[model samples]
Target: MAKSILIVDDAAFMRMMIKNIVSKNGYDVVGEAENGQVAVELYKKLKPDLVTMDITMPEMNGIEGVKAIRGFDPNANIIMCSAMGQQAMVMEAIQAGAKDFIVKPFQQDRILQAIGRVLARAEQ
Candidate 1:
């Protein structure tokens, strides 16, 4: 079965771009969220195989979301996203327990590669 992924991005356009990339590569998009809090809620509700999450967002950021989801489920597979100039925050998110991260503006190969690696880890 294709890996089920939950996409979390503040911009609808970004979400759509990622969804298109992920789905086209044979992953199942289980859901999408606009912020960290919602991403956590959706994580519990969906229990997707992996999550692609943006670093900056309202009502909480990806670092906090990573921590929260990790708090709830230490084994959750989360990949953080970030734009340029946010390397510090990206590092923090990774330390907070994200399995990995991808930088935007959405390189198709990197995004798919991150998801593939995360799913492979879950399989092992």
Candidate 2:
């Protein structure tokens, strides 16, 4: 079966862009959330194979989201998404349990590569 993914970003356009890319690449987008809080809830409900999470959000940030989800499922596969110059927070997200990250104005190849690499790691 195709790997299921949950997309979480405050920007609607970003979510749409990610959905279009992953869906076209044969990954199933199982759910979307506008913030980390909702992403955590959806993570519990959907139990998706992976998650693409945004760092800056209203209620909860990506680092916190990664922590929360990792708290629930220690082996959860999560990739952080951030804009340029948020290197510190990206590092925090990785420490908080995110497997990898993709920078915004997302390059299609980079997104695919990150997702592919993370998912492949999970398989082992």
Candidate 3:
């Protein structure tokens, strides 16, 4: 079965870039959100196999969103995606139960590799 993924980012362009990369790699894009609150809601509704979340967003930040999702579903497969210089927030996201973190601007191969690794580990 194709892996389903949900992408969360404040910038529509960033989301598009990610969507282009993931979908082209043969994954199904279940849904997308422009903020953390919406991401959490969509997560509950869609139950996608994986979620790629941005660090900073309106309504709630990525770390907070990660916490909410983790609280709602302990087994959630979330990977944090952030800009060049948010290492501290990245650590928090991981501690909040995110499976991994991918720094932006996302390199296509690196992004796919991170997603593949997370999904593979989750399936095990």
Candidate 4:
């Protein structure tokens, strides 16, 4: 089965861009959220195989969402999405329990690679 993914981003364009890439590459996008708060709620309800989360958002940021989700389920597979220079926040996301991260303006190969690596960890 294809991995089910929750895509969270405040920008509609970003969400669509990611969806197109992952779906074409054989991942199932189970749900989408525009903010971390909604992401957390959807996570509880959907329990997707992986999540691609944006770092900056209203209501709650990705770091806080990562922490909250990890608090609920330690093994949740989360991959943080960051802009060009958010290295500090990306590190924090990892420390908060994100499995990995992908830098945007969405490189197709990198995004898919990150998903593969993060999901593959579950097999071990």
Candidate 5:
């Protein structure tokens, strides 16, 4: 079965871009959330195989979201999405339990590679 993914981003455009890429590449997008708070709630309900989370959002940020989701599911497979100059935040997200990160504007190959690697790792 295709891996299920939850996409969390404040920008509707970003979510659509990611959804298009992953869906075309054989992943199932199970849900979408506009912020960390919503992402956390969806995480529990969806229990997706992976999540692609955006870094700077209202209500809560990616780092906080990572921490919250990890708090609930220690083994949750999450990948952070960051813009340029957010290396510090990206590192923090990784430390908070994100398995990997993708820089925007996202490259199709990179996005696919990141997802493939993270999901593959989770299987082992």
Candidate 6:
């Protein structure tokens, strides 16, 4: 079965870009959220196989979302997406239980590769 993914980002264009890449690569986009709060809620409802989360967002940030999700589901597979130069935030997100990260201005191959790696790790 295709891996189900939840794409979380505050920017519509960013979400669109990620959606395009993951869907074309055979991942199912089960849902999307504009912020961490919504992302957490959608995660409960959809229970997707993976999540691509943005580091910065309105309402709540990706690190907080990762924490919230991890609190409920310790095994949640999350990949953080952030702009370059936010190494601090990226580190926090990973420490909060994110499996990996992809930088913004994203490349299709890198996005797919990160997703693949995170999902593969979950299987082990």
Query: What's the best-to-worst order under lDDT?
Result: 2, 5, 6, 4, 3, 1
Expressed as tens digits, the lDDT of each residue in 16-84 for candidate 4 is: 999999999999999999999999999999999999999899999999999998888899999999884
Residues 1-124, candidate 1: write the lDDT tens digits. Answer: 8889999999999999999998998889999999999999999999998888898899988888889989999999999888853778767887999888787776899988888888888889
Better of 4 and 5 by TM-score: 5
Candidate 1 positional error at 22, Å: 0.8
TM-score of each model, in listed order: 0.94, 0.97, 0.96, 0.96, 0.97, 0.96
Q: What's the CA RMSD for each of the models?
A: 1.1, 0.8, 0.9, 0.9, 0.9, 0.9
Q: Runs in model 5 with CA error above 4 Å?
A: none
lDDT of 4 at 3: 88
Query: Comparing candidate 2 with candidate 6, which one achieves the higher lDDT?
Result: 2
- Tell me how candidate 4 scores on lDDT: 0.91
CA lDDT of each prediction against the hidden true structure: 0.89, 0.94, 0.91, 0.91, 0.93, 0.92
* Local accuracy of candidate 6 as per-residue lDDT tens digits, 1-124: 9999999999999999999998998999999999999999999999999999998899999999999999989999999998954778777888999999888787898998898888888999
User: What lDDT does model 5 reach?
Assistant: 0.93
Tens digits of per-residue lDDT, candidate 5, 1-124, equal 9999999999999999999999999999999999999999999999999999999999999889999999999999999998854768767888999999898987999999999999999999
lDDT of 2 by residue, 1-124 (tens): 9999999999999999999999999999999999999999999999999999999899998888999999999999999999954778777888899999888787999999999999999999
CA displacement after TM-score superposition, residue 71 of candidate 1 (Å): 0.9
Worst 10 residues of 2 by lDDT: 84-93
Q: List the residue pairs that clash in candidate 5.
A: none
